[model samples]
Each structure stands twice: as C-alpha cells, then as structure tokens.
Target chain A: MTELYQKQRAMRAMRKAAMQRGVIAVLDVGTTKISCLILRFDGVNLNDEGEGVGSISGHSGFSVIGSATTASRGVGFGEVLSMRESERAIRTALQSAQKLANIRVDHVIACFSGGKPRSYGLAGETTVQNQVVAEQDIARVLSACDVPDYGDGREVLHAQPVNFALDDRSGLADPRGQLGERISTDVHMLTVDEKVIRDLAHCVKRCDLELAGVASSSYASAVSSLVEDEQELGAACIDIGGGSTGVSVFLKKHMIYCDSVRLGGEHITRDVSMGLQVPIASAERIKTINGGLLATGMDDRDMIEVLGETGDWEHDRRLVSRTELIGIMRPRVEEILEEVRSHLDAAGFEHLPSQQIVLTGGSSLIPGLDGLASRILGQQVRLGRPLRIHRLPQAYSGPTCSSIVGLSLFAAHPQDEWWDFEMQSDGYPTRSLKRAVRWFKENW
Target chain B: MSQINPDRYTRSDPAPSLWSYRLLRLMLSPYLRRMVFYGIPALFLVGVGVINITNEQRREQVLTTYSEMKTFVTERPEFTVNLMSLKGASDSVMQDIREVVPIDFPISKFDLDLDQMRQIILGLGPVKDVDVRVRSSGVLQVDVVERLPAFLWRRDDGLEVLDATGIYVRTVTSRLQYSNLPLIAGEGADTQVAQAKQIFVAAKPLKERLRGLVFIGERRWDVVLDKGQRLMLPEEDPVLALERVIAMDQAEDLLTRSVKAVDFRLQNRPTLQLRSGAMEAFREIKLMQLGQIK
Candidate 1:
C-alpha cells in the first residue's frame, strides 16, 4: 500500500511538473481508437473563488492546441494487448497531434477503460485533539480509515475522501477550523489490475513519454459528460466504448464508484460480421450506417451492401436489410447496457436522489441508444456529448471523443486523491520531529 | 459496400515505425528542429569557410582579393587626387613645401597620409602652419601659413632672416636686399629679436644716424651709429636706457661731439669714451685755460 502511495505521489508530482511546463498531452487509449489531445495551459484560472462556470465551463485555463485520433491496434478492452503495436499506435496519434500543435509533449496523462475496476467505500473516525478541526486532524481521520484487502495483483487507482462528518452532524464537505469533537470521513477507493497499469505505463514509456497520471476512462468520461447539476445531484455515466463499456457513478461532484464491462461496440461489430458472413471492416461500416437499437418497419426495406475481398463477385455484392443489421447489433449493445445496469445496481445507484444516466463514448452515437437505455437503466437516460473546450475541432465534438475530452479536463484539474495529502505521522516508520514539537506546544 | 472494399485495399498502416517515430519527435523538438533547419547549415558554411581559409595559398588568395577589392573602390575617379594646390605661401616657400612634401599626381586619397605630409612641410623654414586636405574635385589642397621675416641676424655662417618670435625663416645673401630690416649680430641675438625691435623703436629719433643694434652678450644691446659710435645699454631695461641715450643726444647733440661710445650699462651712471682726436683737443683747451702749454 505504501509503495502504491509513493508511486501515485510520484505521478502526482509529475503532473504538477507537466502543468508547470504549460503543455501536457492527454491520451485516451481506447479499444477502438487511440486519441491524443495536446493541451496548452495558459496559466489562467478563469473560475476564481465562487465564480460559477466562469469561462467555457472553467476550461479557459487550458486550450486544446492539437488533437488526433488513430485506429487502435493490438488493444482490446482498453488494455494494451501487444506492447509494440500499442506503442506504435500511441506514437502515431501523438506524433500527428504534435505535428499539428508544432510542439513536442513530454508528459502524458493517459486513461484506459479496462482492468476490471472495483470500488470500495471506507469509513473512518477519529477524536479531534483540538476543539477545532485542523489539516492534521483531517489527515488523521483519513489515515484512520481501514483499507480493505483488494486482493493480490490489484492496485489502488484512486482513493478520494468523499464526505466528512463531525460528531453527529454528517456530510460536511470540509471540517477544518470547525468546532467538532470528533471528525469522521467516508472515502471511495477504486482498484484495478496492476498488470494493466504496468502494460500501459510501459507502452507510454516506449513512446518516449512520461506517464504523469493514469485514470480510468469511466471516471474521465463522467467528468466531461455529466452536467454540474447531474454530478451534484448524483448521476451515472455509461461510456460505451469499442472493447468495453465503462460505468461510473458521481455524487456531489465526486466519483464514488466506477466499473467497466468487457462487452462493448466492438462485440456488436463482431456479431454483425458473423451474422452477415462479411468482413469485420465492412460490418463496422454497415453497423455505423444502419445500426439502431429500435428497429422500425422502414428498416426492413433499407438494405446495406456488405462488401468482401474474397475474390468472388457474388460474395462481394451481398446486401443485408437494416433491420437484420440492427437485429445483429442490438442484442450485443443491450448485453453491454445490461452489464452496466447490474454494476450500477450493485453500486446502489437506485438509492441516489437523481438516477440520471448519461450515455456517452463512441458507441453512444448509435441512433435510438438513449431510448433503449432509458428502458433498461432509468427514465432519465440521455445521450451526452463532451463539454465544449476551447479550440476543439468540430469533428471531435461528438460523443465518440468524450473520454479523450474528459482526459483533457482531468489533466487540467485533477481531483484530490489520497496521496495528495500529507500522510499521518502515525503511519510513518520513524518518529517525527514535527509531532514532537506539536506535542510540546499543545501540552506546555 | 464499394466504399468499404476500397478502404480495405487502400488502408495503409498508420502507425509509424519506432525509429521513424523517434526521428519525428526529435524533429519536432524546437531546439533540435532549429539546429537542423538553421544551426547545422550555418555551422556547415562557417566550417567550410574556416577549412578553406586554413590553407596558406587560399588564405593569401583571399587576402589579395580583399585588398584588390578595397583598392577598386578607393581608386575611383571621384576619390583620386590629380593635383596639389598650394595657398598662402610665397613662391620660394611653396617650392620648398613641394620639395618637402613629395607626392605623385593621380594617386588615390586613401594612399595619401596628409598628417605626415603636413609635418614634413612644416619642417621647411618659412612654413609656420599648414593645412592639408583632398578636395572633392580631385585636388590635394595644401594651405601653408609662412612666417614673416622680421629681422636679419648676422651669424658666423651668414645672415639669416628671423621672424618676430625668433624663428629662422630664410638666409639672405646681402644686407641691402632687406635694408629696411634692422641687423642684429652676436650669439643668441636671434632670441632677443623682439627686444631689439623694441629698442629700435625707442631709438627712432636717431634712425638716420643709427647703423644697427648689436646683441653684446646675449643679455644687453649695443646701439651702433654710423660714426662708429656705440651705445651700450643695460640688460634689465635696455630699451629704456636707449631711450634716455636718445634724449640726451637730442638735447646736447652728444652723439656728434666726437664721442666714440656711450656706456649706460648701469642705471645710476652714464659715461662716454671720446675718440683720440677729441681727447687731444679737449686737453689743449684745458692747457689754454690754465696757460701751461700755450
């Protein structure tokens, strides 16, 4: 645990250094595509204290200088399957983006939607040594949380303090300098397979980039796709990616739970290919053009030609009705949404005040996905596009680029994680001189 | 279906090779890009130049070419001096100046050293100051201020004309050539030309009788008259002494009384040394007055 804390701290420090450099690249290594967006931080904070949504949703601090996307290779379920191929794919996207920006980016904040994330909610309480709560008291309360055994070969990706409670009163956002006898906090910790992180880091390192920070694509997409009120009132963002569908639950502007399903739009494409006896590429094209969750009578007449390069003229000229194509795609998409529904239910998402579900990512572009999602997830289901950022091209303004856009926002403004705070001195191996001085000051 | 088939055939691998990716990144780096696009070429050109110039023959060739180019610009007709115009000097003094400042016509002004040439011209006796410049009309104008000969000093070698400040101007062959100029003779007399001229002014009443003033011991002046009589004046106020001598001579006709010389070297005393005949006549007058040798 301490090793992971040190590693996360190092990454946080690197992120701060990248922010200091004023140029950072946000790479979303998705199953279907690798998208890179180079953000140039102008060091301007548009949203000051209490300035609500100051400029472009508080994104005036950075501008998207360059953006590029390339078809992913050797990546499945948002995990790097082949190191060499993924490295090359990353290189391709980053090189093109750097070419567009006319600058070199060294630090990258990457996100992936694989690794089978598990969320844990921890509660800890401690008696405040002073009448008013201090930063140390908060740290002590946070350190008092009992970390659960997330099992071997899994690493804690994010551990964020979600709520602070003072004595009988609860849900205090901050308890510092408040009259409280006892301070307690609720922390949300998400863990993923360690091998996935190592592989992604290796790929990024192979591309000559420093991995400044790594985030789950589900959390990143939630950051961009969920509206401010939706995040505050509690909402769930379902990112239907190529190889995975990422589900993240946000409440009070914080992500409490996130998980990803192995099934995604790529499964639908594969289903289409097998059902129509066509090539994977043609099936992808057919699914994009004709794919719908709710089939109509008119869809039965609309035929999509499935092309093949098998050197047989008859085989290359095959046609499939849109309804038939939808018949092939809808079940896989439904399976993915059903898998997300189970994860949301397990997270107790139905208990939240607002069960608003936002459907985003590349697969969310299918027509009639929201109508079908509203039936399965909840009535508040809606298709979400990423928030508008400065200098983003029109082509990247679709639901497909949500994770990458969200990763840019994550790079600009990262949430405070467990490693961001000073660890309680009791967790230290050696006696602290500061603790000794504090003891003398309090007692003397 | 047709569109998908074409894309399958034309779908090139978009991933760059590892080496190509690294090279592209290196090229995108601002420092390395500037080095490749601007620095390397500049350094290459400078290195080639340095290598070429390192050879002795090439170095000599380059130097010669540079100097030839320089002369090509300097030798233009507008910059060339075709003639020298002498001004504010007499013919003889101008001839002396031309002799001292030897230069060939049609030479470039850049090749001429005016200051050195001015110094050489100033070495001539009559030139007090000189200004040398090359005019725009291809003329080297030399303006000379010649010293005026104020007195003729008769030295052991010959008589030389001296200016008012006692600087030698020229040599004179005969005294009559500058008869209006007073003659001064003796060692170091040229240094006292100013005082001698002042004494001459003081002795203006006896100008017809005065022959010249001689610098006796480099300290005092002796006024010589045509009758072989001399007035030895004191050094401190020689002009005043001479003035007093002239006043006495005017009142008593003392200079025509057969006196050989008047001595006024001391301010409190005046003396006269008479000629032999004048002394014998003075004694016979005394004997007639005393009835001793009638």
Candidate 2:
C-alpha cells in the first residue's frame, strides 16, 4: 500500500536531517539488554574522492563518544511485550549515554531482532535508454519490481539493490555510466511484523526522541561480526542473542537473506534453571562460569556450586559437576543451532560460493561454540566478536556488544537503498514478480 | 495473495497506468516520506488559512502589523555601528587606511560585509594584514599590521623601502627619512633584503665606512665602502666569508689598505685586486727580492 511507502520515505527524510546535524544516537533494543551509542560525524563525504560507487556520505568517518547499556525489562523474544517498561529502560540507557557524551541527542536510529523477519530476493530489469544507464534508469528499474504482498501484517524494513548486471557483464556493483542494451538488478527485501515497528516508534516518541531510522538487529550484527573478506566472498553471521538467535547471509557485501530463531542464550539458561531446579540468576552465573558444549573426563571431577537464592539453607548450597551442568546446557544450544541450520537450508544458503559461518553474540560466548556449530552446521565456523571501535572501552569489545557496535556502523555509513535515487517510473506489483521469477528461473 | 486494492491493478493502458504508478510510487518512496508527512498537513493548514483569509480587510491588517514589527526590530539603536576604531597601526598609516576604506558610520552592523571590508583594507600599500570585528560597545574595530621597512633598495623604478621578506612597502622619496637602515641596490635587490640584512649585521664593525651594497647578477654581494672600495663576497655561505673578512679587517685593517676588491667566490685562496700604484710597487718589491736571491 502507499502508506508503507510513505512511512519509509518519511524515515529516510528523518535520517537525512539527523545526518546533516552531524550527531546521532544508535539504540539497540535487544531482549536481554538495551544499549545506546552516540556517534559524532566529522562531516567528511566519502564520495568527495574518486572511489568505488558505494562511497556515500555514510561511509564518512565517525567516532563514538558515549555508550551505555541497561538491563532490558518487559521484552521477550526481541519484541516489546510491555511498552512502559521498555520505554523506561530505553530512557535510562539514552540518558546515561547522553551524560557521558555531554550532549543531548534528539534523534535516534533503533535496531531490533524481533517480529519474525522474512527475506525475499526480488529482481528488476529495464531496457537501457540511449544505450547507457543513468541514475534515473536504475531507480526506474527498482521501482518497476513488484512489491510482494508479504502477508497483511508485515512491513518492508529493507529493500536494497544487491547486484546489477549490464548485458553480459554481470555482478556490476554500479552500472550508471556503463553502456549496455539492458540493465538488470537483483534486490534483497526484508519485512517484519508491522506492529513491533509501531510499538518501537511509539515508545521512542514517548521518550521525547525522534526515530530517525530503523534496522534489523541481525543485519547489524552480521555487518559488525563478519570480516570484510567473508562478506565479499559470501558468509553467514549467526548472532545468538539472549532471547533470540539472528541468522543473516552476506554475499558481495550485501545481505541477501536474513531470519531469526526465537531461541537464544536465555533459553539455554532457562533450561538449566528448570533441569536443576536452581534460581534463574544462579543458572546464569553457572552458565557463564562453567558452560561448555563439549565435555570431558576432567569436567566430571570439576564441580560448580550453584548458589540458590531461595533463602533456605538446604537449597542454597549445592554443588554439581561441570559435566552434569554441560549436559543440561548442550541440548538447548544444539536445538538453537539446529533451528539456525534449518533456516539456512530453507534460505538455500549453500548456493553461495563461500559457506563460512560466523557465530557471534552473548550466547555464542559459550566455550567451544564454534566447534559445535561447525560440526552441526557442516561449514567452517568461527567465533565472532564486534570489531574494535575508536575509543570503545575494552569491556564492551566482546561478542555481546556486536549489535550495538554494528548499529553505530550502520548509522555512520548506511548502505544505499532503493529510495536514495529518483526513479524514472512508478508503481506496479506484477512487473517485479515476473522479473524475479525470470531471474530465479534463469539462475536456478 | 489476497488483493487489498485490486482496482489499482485493473488499469492496463501503459500511459495512464504508468503515470498513476509513478505518482503513487513517488508518494510511497521513503525518500519523500517527510515531505509527504509535512506537505499534506501543511497543505491542509494553508488551505484552511486561505479560506479564512478570503476577507480582504483581515489580510491588509496582517500585512500592516508584520511590516511594523519588522521595522521596529531592525531600527533598534543597539544594533547600529556608532563608532569605528583602528588598532595596531601608526596614526598616519591608519589615516591613509581610513581614506582607502571609507565607510559611513551609524549603519546597522548586520548590513556590513566584514570580509569585504577586510579585503579592501589589506589592499592598502602599507597594511600587511587586517582583522575586522564588531565589539559589544557598538564599535566596528579594525586591527592592522603595517609592513616594517627592513632595507632601502635603489632599483630602476627609484628608491623604495623593502620589508624583511623583500616585499615593496613604500617608495622612499627622501633617503634621510631611512638614514639608519642599510642601503642596497641592484636589478633584483628588493627580494634579497634578508641576505642584505645578514650582511649588514656582520659588517657592523665597518658600519661607519660602509656606504651600501650592490647585488651583482642577483647572486653575489659587493660591499661598497665610503672610500670607494668594494668587497665582493661569494654566493654560498657569504655570512661565513664576510665574518672571515671582518676578522681580517679587525686584525690587519684590510679595508684601510689600497685593495680595491676581495674575491671570495672560491672557498680558498682569496684574490685581492690592489690599486694600480699598489700593484706596481708590489711587483717591483718582488723583482728586487728575486735579484737578491740570484
């Protein structure tokens, strides 16, 4: 509907205004924790120099001056179940970060991994005008693509042209100046539940801050965790969060597919709590201290004390072998991994040239996670940590801060989207569908 | 997929369909979202205002009141430049600068172009740099740095005062005004003021006898004495050569001798051209010494 398009345009305008102001706050509204980062841009334009086409102003430089995190409340499965509690938590994080930065932020770009994200690869093509493609021609081709219904309750979050081909020259990142008879593009579109987005916007409004932009938490995590080579060659970044595990596939520096599994580190902790009848806090401590995927004979002799807060002397002091604790934690972690693998299979991720898997997030911190993921997922797997940021504290340079750091990166240098250009033509649904089907048929 | 709006898809003609599609797509595109959000509401508000303002009497009243408020704020006395002051310049140079960049006072500070005024002031002959600022005391302050005369050069154009960097500052109509400064002359002597200043500093011992310096070929310096003697100095490390010559003069009173010139172009074995009479006497003495040895 035109309403969805209008909302996206409005968000883009807000993002532009915020960027022009040279300072913006990036908020990561995760299930377990909410983080806020304030970035100051140095007003350097990337495209000012002669470089590859993606050198937009976002690729300009920025530095994080303030960052704060708070325990998230009224959030489950990355979705805001209680608006009041989530708003309070977001305010606390933003205020503390603002204090550290010594500047009040009025605009914030938020990222979240909730509302069940769905990815679709849409393709578009147009006959070259004057035997060469202009910016308008590319825009026209993008707008020509069919807007999938994507169900009634879902809304498009990201619609970006991933690849462009001109005549026989395929895999063209940008083809505006090239001479070709026909120009075709493959675009990646991700949609999520509309209600969650509305809730987040409303919450941000209530906090007296403007929602400048929004992104998928999984996509952000992937951008921060995946190495540059892995992204170019093809790789999947599976961000295992506290309440949800995010799976995003990147190829040629573009995310072609993304999905989230409703299970994460919290679920494993819950399983430990239920299996051992220990307190949730104690289970978390035990998980952090003695959690591992592969156990050995030495673990059997190593005992971890699970302190109970029930206030009863009998139940408060109990020691369990590390192997037994690992026994309780492995199945849930395996289940989450199994679900992630199934999503990858459903996405047909094996078709990409590279099958490197990067496992990151707070949950992925479990000792021996990469080994277990590689064994189960059947690909080269590595533990991912957020890339080091300038002046970022050493405490936050871990897998847990991947989403927030990635969100900062996204805010500083956003990938070019479809609406960034002026299209030559307007609205149709069937043209994109036919083009996508043709592309799929030809490629498959 | 179930169609929520099938009527929009029923149009088959490419012309009308494309136009409508383009319009809808443009409106829906996120890039224009803010414009639509604001434009729709603003358009509605403007429409309502236009309908209400259809009465000519009310429109005239609003315009009259707006103009009155604009004039009231712009005419405030505090915003006017009441006084202009110049800083860091001699009174005569300041007066000359004022004549070059004259402005009528009692004007609004906002109406003044500070950068343009600064540029004009810098164009003055003696002004090296200028800074223009408006103080809270309703004064437009101009700070100027006048070029200092480093050396007086006699060029084909006439006598002129040169700054330390060899930039022409002013024409010296009379030499008595700058009698204390060193005098230099050549085709390109103005640009070599720094080197001339160094030579003058090194030749302080013979300052009384020193007349001036002639820059030859824009390279070597010929130190002219008041007694009509010239000391030709080498191009490289002329300071060291001048120091050595000064030391020899202190010990042997070399400048008082009948030597006409000393060539130190070669690092070693300096050659001195003596007066003709002195040269003949030196040759006769050398012949007498040869005859005694025989």
- Among these predictions, the greatest lDDT belongs to 1
Q: For residue A257, what is the lDDT in candidate 2?
A: 96
Quote the RMSD, in angstroms, for model 2: 22.3
Per-residue accuracy of model 1 over B70-166 as CA lDDT, tens digit each: 9899999889999999999999988788787788888998999988998899889889999999988999999989898889899899889999999
Candidate 1, residues A1-444, lDDT tens digits: the string is 679879998987787777777889999999999999999999645345223322211233799999899998989998989988888898899989998998889999999999999899999999998889877898899889999988999999889888999999998776678898988999999999999999999999998999999999999999999999999999999999999999999999889999999999899999988998877887888888878979999998998877777767788787778898888888887888889999988999999999999999989989999888888888998999999988999988898999989988888877767876666766454557678888999999
* Alpha-carbon DockQ of candidate 1: 0.32
Identify the runs in model 2 with alpha carbons over 4 angstroms from their true place.
A46-52, A425-444, B1-294
- Clash pairs, model 1 backbone: none
TM-score (0 to 1) of chain B for each candidate: 0.84, 0.72
- Which candidate tops TM-score? 1
Lowest-lDDT window of 10 residues in candidate 2 chain A?
A49-58
